[model samples]
Target: LETVGYTLVVNPKTCVVCMDRPREVAFELCGHFVCCAPCANSLGHGVTPARCPLCRADASHQRVMRRAASLHVATMADDHMHPPPPPPPRPPPPPLPRPPPLRPRARTTSLGPTPPPLPPPRP
Candidate 1:
């Protein structure tokens, strides 16, 4: 939430993936904050593997982001002792549309012998 006098908010750091939020979640292996916690949780979600956005290193130990008192941090976790609960699981993604059946190629029959290829001209 912005303050009463805060007309505009500009983040000094940005996630490479979202290009919006501050780069908060740092990967211990690469020592880079490729994205924030939400984005990191999002990247860590599902079967897909999470990797550092900058160096492409396999993100092992996710580190907490520490900012100066002046720097504004997004999300309730930054403020409250207990972070907000994860939103209800989203409905399973719609099933992928089945691909159309392939049609067999038509066969061509020639009664006469094929013509020979033309010779290339010398440069």
Candidate 2:
């Protein structure tokens, strides 16, 4: 005989507020897994201002419970299904060194030599 195990899956897209996996917690009203604690709190108390995190349905009278089975499944799924977080960014490469400026060439003409003037033309 062969044995197989079944697991519950939580859809992240269904919940708008949860940062972590939705399977970590379960909804009180709809019995559907939605978001984490922060999201649950935002929906108001399960009995008072009750609201569904995913569908925004009225959940004032529903009961909230911690789902151990679902949480276990989520943890296992997380371990095998998720990709490793990206590495931290590296520092930019050092700026390139600038080349030295070229020196001006010396002039060959003598500094004190005077130039010949034009002769006067006949009228």
Candidate 3:
């Protein structure tokens, strides 16, 4: 259990394969948070999709679950733990420069300059 702002949060579920780390990945089709990222990647190797270990559902794609902040704030006056302030917002990037206008290309004959008119037939 984790304490955040005097509230208790339960994070007791661990990965099914490793049984060590907490379950942080959820199968898209089965909607089960039973495996960690490494375990899921191992199962879903190559072209074959991984099957849900719990429900046997197709788990070709899975998403990682974001854990809640572990910051602990006390209710009484003696507790001094405080989360750091967030950084200031960043400025927007500058706009890109416009490209120059394109000029029209001159039209040419298909036979490539007409072979200089065959030098007047070499009379």
Candidate 4:
């Protein structure tokens, strides 16, 4: 957008206040268009007084501009926004093997199995 006498050229996409982010705000005090959201919120909602960038006036409330203001914003691509897709899911682990079953001892007719003949009474 060009004015009659002078032209205020900006990178469009850059924040008017910080010149980093895309134009995301518009201070209502002065007709300065498109500052980033952080700057807008800080100026408007912050504890300190609001100050307009273009003119040194009170810019308390700012309008958040959306992507619809594409023309006024620079056309810089943010590749970091998108990340590679996650890896595919892995197969389930194999089932564990089962242990053998225990068995009970057999009983004998002699008393305590004859105590193994007592070693011939130790001679």
lDDT of 4 at 68: 76
- Can you list the residue pairs that collide in candidate 3? none
1-123, model 4: which lDDT tens digit per residue?
Answer: 345567766565566677677666655545455567787776645466887665545677667757676434223222112222355799999999898888897977766534545555665
Candidate 1 residue pairs that clash: none
Instruction: List residue ranges in candidate 3 displaced over 4 A.
Output: 1-12, 46-48, 69-123
- lDDT computed for candidate 3: 0.63
Total clashing residue pairs per candidate?
0, 0, 0, 4
Lowest lDDT 10-residue stretch of candidate 2 = 76-85
List lDDT for all candidates, in order: 0.62, 0.52, 0.63, 0.59
lDDT by residue (tens digit), candidate 2, 89-110: 9999999999899999987877
Model 3 collision count: 0
Per residue, candidate 1 scores C-alpha lDDT tens digits across 1-123 of 234585744343666677677777766665565577777777646776877666656775787776554244323322322322356798999999999999999787987789999899999
**lDDT-superior candidate, 1 or 2:** 1
Best by lDDT: 3
Q: What is the lDDT of residue 73 in candidate 3?
A: 12
TM-score for each predicted model, relative to the true structure: 0.43, 0.32, 0.43, 0.41
Give the poorly placed runs of model 2, Cα more than 4 Å off: 1-15, 45-48, 61-68, 71-123
